[model samples]
Target: MREFDYQRLVIGYHGCDASVRDKVIQKGDQLQASPKRYDWLGHGIYFWEHGPARALEWAKEQKKRGKLKTPAVLGAVLHLGSCFDLLDAEYTDMLAQAYPLFVDSTKAAKKTLPNNRPLDASDKDQLLRDLDCAVVNWTIEEFEKDGTAHFHSVRGVFQEGLKVFPKSGIHRRSHIQIAVRDPACILGYFQPPSKR
Candidate 1:
């Protein structure tokens, strides 16, 4: 059987308020996991993989929304241990399998399945990922029930925003993101040199 552990270290950037960054880097405070139902990769501390610029952009947007006072980026060294990597066929197939189970569970509980919706009313990108988040959370819970190895992180690629060029497949905001469920997988935090 193929071990799911990725083993290699990768850098991730988290966009947040400047005060939050200061507390994490200067005071050694940990980043709290987001438990929002619409989280793209489920309840975890999320980061943009190797995309500081994009992270900063997100933070700036958040600031505009009054979520933060000043935008900043906090860099992290991460090990994607036993990750549920959506980029791979194996995991995507598993996620597809999990969808029906998730729906069944919802129906059993007399709850309706949630839908993914655009954050902005007219946007094509479904930024509010309620359905995706629910499915991922359900799949992970099922894995735990089966006594399978725990997934420390969930990683996925998102093609978002407007196309980079006319008829181009690439999106301007496309990026790979990681949601770290295991705090231990985060080796250290740093101030990205570019911004220093």
Candidate 2:
């Protein structure tokens, strides 16, 4: 990995329920010391600002661990009630090992929405087509309707908007802004380029 000033922190994100929140926070703090040690693909895909290369690395590691079946990456928009949800990377790392199964539990794309206003079909379809990876948003109240809802891969979804520095290789850059963020916090995951 290239040396950078980036600091790894685990921000608290609202869970499906109170118990879930408690468990997540507890895990977050534990992994704060070594956040990168965890296979972060599922959650990092959307919620993180770490860029595409890091996200792809997470996905690759997860696949190696058998945490995920496919190389495809995805993410969720967490609604952590208040914006105060950051734990140290060490805690996240600890959490990753403590609860191996929880790492992949975030498969279903979800966002922390305040209410049940469904996304327009045409607009939503267009948004999905624009992304290079699959995405799903969930809220606390409304449960996602599996069949009626769509799940798509990044190649089948977004288009390029911006470019960011690569995390590890030479002269490589990442494409950004493939889709609009509904709540601003939930930036969609990136379609990381395959190793060159």
Number of the top-ranking candidate, with lDDT as the measure: 1
lDDT of 1 by residue, 1-196 (tens): 2344678678999999999999999999999999999999998999999999999999999999899999999999998888899999999999999899889999999998999999897779989999999999999989998998589999999999999999999999999999999888898999987654
Residue 73, model 2: Cα distance from true site in angstroms? 3.4
lDDT of 2 by residue, 109-137 (tens): 35221222222553322222211111112
| Clashes found in each candidate (C-alpha, N, C closer than 3 A) | 0, 40
Stretches of candidate 1 off by over 4 Å are 1-4, 194-196
Name the Cα RMSD for model 1: 2.6
**Predictions: Cα RMSD each:** 2.6, 19.6
Candidate-wise lDDT, in order: 0.92, 0.28
The worst-scoring run of ten residues by lDDT in candidate 1 lies at 1-10
